[model samples]
Target: MENEVQRPLADFPVNIWEDIFTSFSNSDLGSDKLKEKHITLKETVKESFMASRANPIENIKFIDTLCRLGVSYHFEKDITDKLEKSFDCLDFNQKIRQERCDLYTVGIVFQVFRQFGFKLSADVFNKFKDEDGKFKAHLVADARGMLTLYEAAQWSTPGEDILDEALAFSNAHLEEISSRSSPHLAIRIKNALKHPFHKGISRIETRKFISYYEAEEKCDSTLLEFAKIDFNLLQMLYRHELACVTRWLPEAPNGIPDSMKHLYRTIIDFYDKLEDELEKQGRSGCGFHLKKSLKSTSNGYMQEVNWLKKDYTAKFDEYKENAILSSAYYAIMGVTFVGMGEVAKLDAFEWLSSHPKIRTAAEIICRFTDDITSYDFEHKREHVATGIDCYMKQFCVSKELAVHGLFNIVSNAWKELNQELMRPHSFLFPFLMRILNLSRIIDVVYRYEDAYTHPEFLKEHIVSLLIENIPI
Candidate 1:
């Protein structure tokens, strides 16, 4: 066989971004003044939670605020307890039958319940439908309601036609309202349209929401201040973690490039320690299986290198098979194996190795969205053919059509992911959440653009999540 021409070099250079973490100051992090303020605000928030216990509506709103502000993890127990109590007291049937539920309350309550794994019927939304069985047209004017409805719809399972309808209906009206809305409202709508709250990374959403909420006419000053303080403190902790990782980069194995070695070694070391811990706990089989899973994840990088060396456009199916591996979906699954219970870890590894539909769906979302946004830059470089190239070459379609087809693939993949999430499964919900969160991160980073490769769009998130401290 004749040797083929090597792929041309891409215009983009290797990731050469400066180490922003090196400048982070440890002394300034978690200062006495900040710690005192954090405690005061935290107590205030906790007191509010106690006061709201008598009012389910107030309690739900408080829980929703914590989630939106990205501080819910700090109060997980309190929020879970409040939600459980509220769920027990509030009767969905009576609330709907008595016409006591508005779109905002119903949307919030439904999303909270579903998010916490307290199964609720999609029929809660059916009351909003008119006699003709369509979402009430009057609801279109309420942008808050529409946005919440749009987010709540993301929890829909298979055969839930009402949620499907809610998604389409709310999306259209929200898009329309965005054009004429106030500057802040318009931006919020635009962002929600691009990345719904349900599919957004919590850290990124909190950073964005802090600004938006601050600008609201009815914004709670205490909550706003507390959110800012908490965000900055959390960023300090993340900075410390990154610094610790950076300190160990020089110890990574040979052969890997300096640029890539840190991340690869970090992931490997995490699993190595986890495996040791599992063995110490007498879960030797689970530890061995997890190590095997890590090896499989490493193989994915090797597969990508092999594909790039070939330098030919593959059919869509062929590209998809390889792309899923190359997209690092397995790495996310492997990482979750750490700290898991023995049976859960073994079962998760088995499910992950089998290439479940949900994993494939998430990989498709990651791979296609990346290809769609980065197509031009990638095509210019020495890269393997992407979904765009495969579809175009196989069907003789235009670039535009190829991109549209790939988008359809991403959409279908999301539906598959949503379906898989709702179905009963043997694996723990936390393990499953790792997959879902990976998909959500893809939506945040790749929607409308390749935020990861470009990095400019991600600067705000990095700064807010790690570098900058909010003013007291």
Candidate 2:
């Protein structure tokens, strides 16, 4: 008995045995071509057992062996199941510190069983389901897992019954369990529906309702209410600030305001009242004034720009104490906030584009307008990244479906722009593209480092392209 026990493991040095086992565990071996028919299952099982025996749990290589073997559960089920038992028997956790496999691996294993048409009971799956499970990461990992299983199921022999298992697994997890999760799980469910092997799965139909902003559901009514208040506050802030900057109304024969001093104090008093109102609402003065105010202020600044262009000697701050210089300085601070707000709006738009179904073009424009009105541009990249992560996780395998819903946004924008052309004071194509590019730069920011931190980098690249009529 001792020799029999020792003999199986004794042939291999500990390192070689562990290496062989690790390779088997981690590799999706079924994905590889099975060339040698002579090596039957019995033979393969015998070889695997021999390798495990040689290394043993006490060997230094056990942890690496376990990691690979855990991964191998995807490909070599018989070997893995048997190995699982052996490890359990040895109380391997006591022998060597072993982290329970990653939750990602759990999803992958479940996905593998699913592709083979194995229908695990709901009770079995509940073992792993938790609200806090790295919900976003699982979405991406599971999508990749499903893709692999799909191909394998396709190639397997008809009577092998793997396809049934795959369908059953998909149904249980995706249709049954996934549909019940909160809409926040939309990104993951979307991706899973796109899984190539989803032919027999019926649950794909249920994902339509699960999203951040479904047709029947909106996230927060309070946020919507606050948005309107925020918009009004912003407009007020802009008007008050503009009054402070432009205290000098030209003294004309019939004009009412000749005293700049009196007007300046009135403007300051108006701003203080407006500030109090904004404070009472628990909103930021920066958010209230940044976006709309910045744009309108920019129109004013353009006049200054034109004056400076006509003559370099033009004094940008000619009006002292209460005039041009004060306005320029304060306006610059407001514009900085506007710049950040523009960045955030752009990031949100890119996210909408990536998941078109969730955000219709009309919805995208509406949201853009809201952001512009509110000027909430702080933490632009972080929001985009987090949003993308949500998208990838929610719609992991169903990216096309989510994207399909988004097409109307661009189409609608085009339609609106065309209609506006007939009206006077409409936005021109260049101006539209320039503003859109401000949003487009968010997409570019993630793709290349230059666009994220540097505004001029986008400006130079885009302006050159615009000048040359280059296709973006």
Candidate 3:
């Protein structure tokens, strides 16, 4: 590779995480008594969850709690079966419908269904609007209701004008009520506004929700204790995973530049193993798609580099088209499906290549979220034109409006992502979850700033998830 062009240099911070995971290993967190207690509490929670099925409202709330506590993996099949039944039944669709329920209950059901990819109409919220097409002013007094609607609205798909209105209504009112609410509700609103649970990382959001759930008047002791135990156990596994990953890290070759070798080798080594395994499975053709995605992503990056080198700004449509690959969502998704075993056959890779709405949504999320937040900082350098830049110059708008416009694109992507998850023909739910989880990471990495460049914002989250232990 010969690059005669002089490139821009960035003075990135030193690695704060150098050898930090060395302190973690399975031996340190071992406690037989805690394990036994975890087993007991898990059974207790399971029984309670199963028995709660008698009440429609209570059952949905129970499901929400389990997920929010980050303990749903323990009873994934149980919850899935229940949701499956509910999905199959017309009654379940209407069981917790907004028309028959208050704003809070309706919001809960909407969010839970959307999160799991259940099809529910956004029209149910239409009744809440007054004849004048505005949310009833009186409803603003219902802080809990407002908060729930705000969370529920995050799942809105394209062309859902009412949901768009609902979003604006809830956002404005939540800001208004935050100052006057009780300490607990105020904190919940603040956190939701800063980091929406629907779009937030699973462990990070669950950690915050567990504390809030513990304070609820209806909180069950058994469930609370189980969540705490499950969190600690998972924390150990995360630590162990980190340690294992660090131990086997390949030494980059001296022949390649230091900056390029690390990432280049990591990708090559991972795909090499993946291709080898697929050959064993006699699905070697799957490797072709993997390579295809990898090549496309590299091409996208190269295209961006060329743009910066030539100081050329791409048209808005051109930028978005290239971003599909540049976002690296497709490349990541290729390997994400590898973990599905036989289910990830050759045609599954073909399906991914088709540019499904869900895939496009995830890519948009990755691109726009980073662009909107990091553009100013990046613009200060010899950066390629970001989506924000393309949109701004194309439309000749102020930076603030451009940011807001790009955010609408991000929001629509979320809606499409939510919509795709509910489709009947979608791949095994786990595959879609890979996309969701990856999208969630965008919020974590670029919520207020690009935490990758500014490590300070990310340090606390890394510590919370991997290093700090949840209290027993």
Candidate 4:
């Protein structure tokens, strides 16, 4: 202890979750009873999907609901199979089919199809526009219609001016309309306005959405119960994994700057174990991509440290080039698809290595969103110039303007990401889903602050995910 070096150190918050996971085990959870109920409810939900087939519109809406509820992973095959069958078969745009679809129906349908990669056109919303190419005034009267339209606009691809207008129009209206709407509807709208479902992480959004879904007038009690139980059961498994990890950490490698070395070895060991596991599963070349990402991320971190140590402010472009790598979403993306069987082949990762549009888009989202939320906290200590700082210096803008510019980049990236996900299926849906989810993780973790560092703010998330069981 006498040899321990004394130096300036970060005033890191105490780990609020200390000893929490270490004391817990999944074995005591009532998983068997939950599973029994889960099975029944799942079947009921599926049977409902099957029975609702006569109305593709309603069925797809339910599919989207299940997804937002975070239980869609359970019905992936069924949803896809049924969707491929008549989602295309219905082809029900009012202009073409003379259908009696309302703004809510059209908006939800457009959003659902696009989300599943259907390449649905923004032109589908043209009827809602008046001759001046503006959304009709009466359309704003219906609060649900505005909310759904706002959500659908969140899925806009590049160059979709109609959707651009819709976003502006609906966003302005939603903020104003919330006060006049019913409490339930207003709560849902405010939630959407703040964290639009299209761009939110599934687990985090699911936790928030369960409450809103439960409050719906036509809340499917069976389906809602299934989601709650499934979430709690998964929470138990997550805790068990953490408990195992906590037990293992102290035994790992150690050195001067002991924590860093320990973390480095832990990460390497993870990839090595993952590679070995993948090899056993005949996913040999996947390790190459994983290691490649790890190397790139390491270099990015090194670059950032060099900048900070030198007190060098990089140009916005230079900072961005490194920031994306430092985001580590590229590495995260590769590992995500490693377990996904044949869909993630060597060529698949090769494509990622080439800096595909979707990958870049996701990286931008991750990096900039983090910078916007954390720069103040980060500035308290010596740190590399964040993207916001870089933009400010480059453009001679205020912090607010610099943040706005970076956010515009994030928004544009989301649009580009949306376009890339359009119906043509250039890559397997599973692989693409990984990239999407990685981006989603950024949105949740870095929304208002660096919750990853100041995790006290994420207490609600921690409790909902690991501690509290949704009462039946």
Candidate 5:
């Protein structure tokens, strides 16, 4: 028990250790710590299960099963007894506990308990075991119960011997339970079950956890289901190893041939020029008349232009070779999600109603519009459309079909925005209102004053961009 009491302090400050211990109870250990604990617990749980199977142990205590679950050093019955008896001794280390708590609290915020949800406070564990006239059972059972929830939610594989051991622990005290079910625990179990391997667990047992305080009925379950599906997609992507590479690829290529390396380089240079030209346009006029430069009039420039067009075609042909399938999949998925922004805005409005935070709402609206205006979204859309257009172009439905599909996505977004405007809710209304006023002021200044065109005024304005006039 001396070692057990010092374990948290030894590895981390006292307060930090307590916070980690709280994590064990909060049940997020599965995602973060399950893999680490698996090796240690494997043999112990197997042995315990085998032992129980060999003979019907009458006491069937949780500690007996816990001994098989894994080794925590303090998990041993004798050590647990010593620690419980000596907890008061360690209680003197207040500074350590505070530090540990702060660390653990950070983890809780960045991970674990995300979003706003009620966490039930109850004794969580009840049955206690008396070994050699010492209180050892309750501590073991409490720790084991918390461990089971963490592992159950976290384990990549669902029904390992450790989980069986956990069930055995829960069953041992089935007859003498006094503490009510934890709402958080129930949510954890439901989330775990969303995975295919865990689907077979007794739904009846899970339902017993349903309580009056479950906030946002079915929302948690829906999110859990979606998260599981996305996780599996991620897992599949990882297995294929394409999840890592697609981010750095260019958004658009004007058909370049790989065989002619010189032409490919020139094409990229042209696009760089295009980017500069677009930036210039943003600062000045929306359109420009093309004037033939001396270089463009030369045969060498004409050859390069022709070569650029050919190479663009070649690059499109080689896109599959250069890009990962998962990269393409996620790119398209991102586009789809962005297209869903309008829908999300509508949902946010529905959620916030008329009392939406106009400031936040306007920011969301601005972000989507800014994406379109800056041509960031257009660049990606053009790349994807280029590829898809190539394949489908043979069909009569090619160009028109692709355009219709993109149009539909954009239309859906606008419809969502309209709905939000009609009935905004949550923080949307207030946030949108604030952003609208700010955008309007900027628009008015740009239209009325040529100050943006003046270098000194531009420098001062850019310097003061995010600064507010009043103190917060």
Candidate 6:
């Protein structure tokens, strides 16, 4: 091999400084004390769930609170059972037609059912429409109702014209209402406008909602306190995870290329720590397999580098096959695997290894979305051929047509993801949720641009979830 001249490959600057992580501390978070408090709060919340089960309305509201507080995962069975029972007792169609049923309640029910994978017709909103078949214009005055409707609208699927219209109607009204609403309501509205609850990360949404919930006049102190304690404790756990990564980075294998060492160490250390935790809980071997998966992921990056060196534009299928490995989707699944039962963990790994349609859909959505948004900036520098380049060259289409085609691909990927999520799969639901959440992240990060590459877009979420604590 000829000695190549050393050259700077790209001008990508580090957007986040090291000091940001250095300043994080769990001392104030009081992990041990918070854990104790969290347990007591969990019991209280559980009791609340039990008590509300007899009262359908109260149970629904409580379920909404659990979701908004981001602690729904902690009580998934309880929520599922309650919602299933509630659905059986109250015919959703009949409830929506009742003269007494308000928009807020109907919206909440619609959203909750869809969120948990229960099929609900968008036509339930028909009663709220007038002769012209438009949502009642007078409904805009009820900001909370409009907000809830707007959120429910996000669950729309292809050809759901009612939901599409509902979204447009609710959005315009909410924007107008938010501008004149009280400070507290305005904050919630602004957050919703920026990132719909359906699309927001659960942990981040929980952090934001705790504050919003507290400001409500009817906020349950016990629930509010539980949310805060639980969030801080999780923050403590995350801080410890990052600390482990920092400690392990310098100890990575020397053979790893300098360019890839940091990422390799971070993912490996994360797997190691998670494995240790899972082992303590009697789940073993997941970490080892996850590490193997990480290696496969890294090889995907190496494959891209080789292609770039050869000035190769891969076939679309070839690009997709490699893109799935490089998308970091496996890493997300690996982290979520920790603490899962051995059967579930092994099953998840099996499904992941096979590159199931759901996982492939998520990766395709992520890769194409990223490439489409970032191609311009990437093209200005030394970069591997992206999906955009592959598709354009393979199809011999104009950039505009290629981009349009890519959007269609992303849409089809979403449909696949939705279909996979709709029915029982080989893996547990929670494991599947990790894949869904990863896809949702792509939706947020690549909504208009690549937010991950441009860190400023994610800074507010980071600050809210980590740097700042909610005032009790």
lDDT of 6 by residue, 1-472 (tens): 4885554366565868465665555574465666788899999988878873444766777788899998887888888887777666656457666878889988888888878876677777988899998889889888888999998887776667888799889987788899889999999988888888887788898888988998899989998899888887777667666666676766766565555677678767867887797677666666677888789789899999899889899988899889888877776666666535665555567667777777788888888888889888788877888888888889999889889999988877875676566545555677778888888888888877777778877888788776666654
Name model 4 segments beyond 4 Å from true.
1-8, 95-99, 256-270, 339-348
Report model 2's TM-score to 2 decimal places.
0.18
Q: Which candidate number has the best lDDT?
A: 3
lDDT of 1 by residue, 353-440 (tens): 7778777888889889888998877766577778888999889999999999988888778777776765364356677778888888
Q: Which candidate do you rate higher for lDDT, 1 or 3?
A: 3
**Candidate 3 local lDDT, 149-251, one digit each (tens):** 9998888877788888988999987987999998888999998998888888999888888889888898888889888888888888888877887877655
Error of 3 at 13 (Å): 2.0
Is candidate 3 or 5 superior in TM-score? 3
- lDDT (10s digit) by residue, model 2, range 1-472: 5544221122211221122212222122222222132124324433544455543432212222222222222234554454355344445333222334333333344333332223222122232334653122243345434433333332222233434454345444554444455555544455445432222111111122112223225333332222222222333343444444444333322443646455545645554664465445443453344333334444445554454345322221231111222133233333332333323333332332232221122234332222222222322311221121223345463434423332333334423432222213222222332333333322233223333333443454333221221110
Go through the candidates in order and give the C-alpha RMSD of each one to the true structure: 4.3, 31.3, 2.9, 3.1, 28.4, 4.0
Please, what's the RMSD in Å of model 1? 4.3
Candidate 2 local accuracy as lDDT?
A: 0.33
lDDT values of the candidates? 0.76, 0.33, 0.83, 0.83, 0.30, 0.79
Lowest-sum lDDT 10-residue window in model 6: 338-347
All candidates: TM-score: 0.83, 0.18, 0.91, 0.90, 0.18, 0.83
- Deviating ranges (above 4 Å) for candidate 5: 1-140, 143-323, 326-328, 340-472
Worst 10 residues of 3 by lDDT: 252-261
lDDT (Cα, 0-100) at 126 in candidate 1? 84
As a whole number from 0 to 100, the lDDT of residue 452 in candidate 5 is 27
Tell me the lDDT of model 4 at 251.
76
Q: Which candidate is the best by TM-score?
A: 3
lDDT of 3: 0.83
lDDT of 1 at 268: 66
